[model samples]
Target: MIAIQALRAYNLFYFSLLSVFISFLPVYLSYRAVSPSDIGLLVGIGSFIGILSQPFWGMISDRRKTIKKVILLTLGLSLLVGFVLFQSSELWLLFLLVGGMYFFMLPTDPLTESLNYRVAEQYGIHFGSVRTFGAIGFASASLIIGFTVDQIGMDRLYWVFAVYGVLTYLMCLVIPDAPVSSKRLSAADLRRFLTYPATLRFFLLILLAAIPHRTNDSFLGVYVQSLGGSTGLIGLAWFVAATSEIAFFALLPRFLRTGREIKMIALASAIYVIRYALCAVVSDPMLVIAIQLMHGITFVTFYTASIQYLYRIIPEEWKATGQTVLAVIFFGISGIIGSFAGGWVFQEWGGAALYLMMAGIALLAFLYSILMWKREEREAETLAGEA
Candidate 1:
């Protein structure tokens, strides 16, 4: 019971800190006089580093059979590097530090999620129930941190991060590590897992779906500002989006039924297309913020379903590594393309054009998801016939 509470608390505080970073970093970079193109490059480079780092740490966790130690190590280093990253104003320094920070920080999320699912299974608790705390933390922190940053100035952003970081680290100290699979992983197992037809197809699908999501994540704050919105409004937008996720996550099991994850992904992808298209047409910043309400619906549906689907397809022994790979695709490879491409588009064609482009990509993802779902249904039917 204590372990369960500790997991919940850790998720809350951890995502609270993450909210500040995700919602404000671009804004902070802009405040520091970094150009949009450069901000994209910095973010892109950081994600590229995340691509390399996530696998390294995931393999370590898998090999050593300890999620807690890796998370603790990464979080400790990230806090230290983040302190310096936030203080630096030079563009080159910013690039250097962002990569260093992301190397440690990016992997922490997947590890926590891997832990969340493991703990949920062990305790016979719903994973979504525990994950709901993270959404709450993100929603609450965005509002509070937005207001606090408005009052205290973006230069002091590090102070807010530090407080949350310390709290999150403390929470981690108490959360028990989840049990690992006793089957030892081999090099052949790793190679075969990566090369598996289903694994490859699923990853391709996630990559398509995540690109637009990551693009929006990289530029939403700047887009709000472009539409003459204040920082507080940016906070409000994220707050609304995240708050909307809580109900969906909490009630997920009620609606998310077995074998529906793929269908849900398709549905979410369709929503993404609509959401981005609507945002493309909106002239008012508040309208854009209003469109953000769709984020909760789209992200929770798409991401949670993807994670659940991953769990179904991956080997139990490779859970950490599989989860980490999912994170890498969502936050790393997609991030690199999204950040760089989004930065370029936002710079050259403006927000409308950028969002329109996103809508088009989302359309592709939606169509592809439909096709994948159909294929899966056919395969299931064939297996049933054999049985």
Candidate 2:
């Protein structure tokens, strides 16, 4: 049977390709001697546009209930955007290109997840198994792109990114369009979307948590390079990280229990305390690279828990909006801010500052979690009284 599993496999194929681009982009831009602020600006613009586009697209997806077309259209737009990036040297042009890519690429994650969930609901296929494909792809791409950056020049890497963008667009063709909803999101629906104050709080909580959570994502490759590490080594580090993420995801579904997500996230943030501190103090290439195992928690744990939280807390109509909120606040905007901040801190306070700042941010997240738990208890009591 042609199954959604096919799309799961494709998700791996496409995102693994993306992992390479992601793993290398910061390092590449930094190597070109791009000013950190400009690098931030470029990344920031893309993120801003991505932040805006996801909700809009999700709304459209919810309203129309047709996911396939949105997926295909976005893939095409991003492919064009990727090629346009190849033509840019002017700052604004690059800004525009990145924004355009953000527009097209942002929806890939949410909509793809939606698709996977629907399929898993219909079929017995586990989501993690599908997700494992993405991890494998990420691990594999890390090796290729990592070695390529070392063997070839970074300048030629845009071509790789551009070509893959095109290839990803093509992948959209084989996968069926996501089932779209024909029902328009109504006033009541909007109200329902907003009624979950706890949900909104959770979104904000993750957003705050995401700021420093992603500093590593935004800077680690370059950080590795700065420590006199090779691109290949950087790639291998990410490869190992992604691989661990895969293993974590493999075992994740079985571990879902009450209060586990909260602990998982809190633990991940705590790990960052040591993870970044290690990055700051340890100069040894081997030891520094070993810290990447922390990525398993930071990205996979934090993300899976956060996304699952959205899936549970968000009303069906506002699902996309809710997911987009997390993306916009934490990954998109906060990520941009963190990148600039990390680069500046690295330049100013040195690498130690970057890690210290992350440690500080993480501690703040830990406090937020405590407060969130209190809020949850109050809400639970209110529900019980109502019952």
Candidate 3:
């Protein structure tokens, strides 16, 4: 029970910190006289480095059997590096510091999820209930900090981030440790894990679906501004999206009991198709904001289902590694591609064209998911017949 509460507190603080960093860091960089191009380069390079770092960190946790230690080490390094980053204006120095921060911060999500899932299982709590606090934190932090940053200056963003970082670290101190295996994964074991059919297929689908989703996330504010929406409207848009996750997450256990994770995932993808397509055609900023309500159906549902699906498929010993792989795929590889490609499309064509392209991608994912679902059903029927 204590562990469950600690996990919830950890998620709340961690995601609150994450919301501040992701939403305001670029603004801080701009305040420091960093050019938009350089900011993009910094973020892109940091994400690329994270691809390698997440898996490495996860492997260390799995091999050393100490997630708490890794969490502490990484968060400590990130805090130190972030402080130093604010003191420098040199492009190269900023690049190095940002890279260091990403290397440390990227692993935190997978590691925390791994720890939380283990703790929830032990405590007989629903993972989604605990995860809902993160959504709440994100929404609340974004709203409060936007007003705070308006009163203060963007230059002071680091102080806010640092305070949350401290709170996150304190929460980490109380999270109960999860069980770890004494046996380490061998090279052959790694290869076999990678070669598994379900693993490969699952990642491929995620990659395809994430490109459009990430593109939308990265540029939704810009899209709103293009429609003449104010900064306040942009914040409202994100707030709506973030808060939308709460109900979905709160109700996730009921769906989990139905044993239809893949079907739910497919339904979420189908919703994405409509969501992005609507964004493509909608001219009103208010309408665009309303469309963000679909985030409840698209991201929240898909994310909840994916976590449950991953937990079911991965071996207990490889849990951290598997989560890290998903992180790397979604945030690292697919993120990079989406950021660059979406920027190009948006530049060359228009916002409508870009969202239409995303809608097309989601449509393909929907079709693929339906096919996979039917195939699995047929296989199940065959086994039952044979029995």
Candidate 4:
């Protein structure tokens, strides 16, 4: 039997393989002659569908208490989509596949993350260290595959994603044999989790943050390549970002390391304003890459805080469900709107304007987060008075 630690690490590694492949999906469509707006539609519609699916999947997982079935079923569906991509190269098919792939893939991370937290709680190991390895994998893939595409050409792209899917299916087999939660949350608890005002605010925070990040995700490839960048530099850029993320994680156990969850999210939101703005105006490749380095503060810091906050705030029965809600709101819905906005912004308004717009989003998020924090404080005082 693999130690739970090893299992957790493997989980992150395999997931990274998938992330690397998926991250470049926008670039892939662009190469295939897909229009930016249509590309946005593809990403957006797929995300919307996936967002809708998340609640259902979460409910299914809640009822089942083990997302094993959800994972297997979704992965199996993903495999079919990957296979179809090879069979048909039509533009419509390409658009359809993007959505199909995302629908199946969105659940993997949030659900697996919930599982990782559970494993860490069960065994005496630092979840951050174990999970940080996944960031390593994500960074490695971004660099490696970006280089590979530059050298070999873009034809190998789908094969890469499909191969990753096959390997991920195999990796899913090794998730440490943890028992499912038999103690389900009651209807009242479930309702409470759904009705929590913080839940709605958190979802909005994800929307605002994701809107800006989508510009980076959707256009960074073309932006770099047009600026005399080779694939090597693109990979290095992502590597730098991931490297920053790793550094942040290391420091996380100390600074803002305590359950100061709201603070971390607020800080990340603030940093994103600066990060994307630099992305727009920096003329030097090195400077652009430097901005990528802030990915550490933007993602790893924000994500860790988010997981902890959601875990603490939601009902136990809705642990996976709550996490899934986060993904659906941020990745699925927000990504869609952002991608569409990004396409227009990149084409008409230009990267600099797009980055500026994204900066504005970060500002909005900061204000919203402050309001939320204050709301929580006031609510606490009210409850105390009643007691």
Winner by lDDT between candidate 4 and candidate 3? 3
Top model by TM-score, which number?
1
Q: Give the per-residue lDDT digits (tens) of candidate 1, residues 63-170.
A: 999999999999999999888887789988888889998899989999999999999999998889899999999999998988898899889999999999999999
Candidate 3: where is the Cα deviation over 4 Å? Answer: 26-41, 84-91, 182-184
Best by lDDT: 1
Clash number by candidate, in order: 0, 6, 0, 1
Ranking by TM-score: 1, 3, 4, 2
Error of 2 at 203 (Å): 1.6
Candidate 1 off by > 4 Å: none
TM-score of 3: 0.91
Q: lDDT tens digits, residues 160-266, model 4?
A: 66766777777777676434666756778867776777677777787887777765776676677656777677777877777677677777767654547777888
- Candidate 3 local accuracy as lDDT? 0.79
Greater lDDT among 2 and 4 belongs to 4
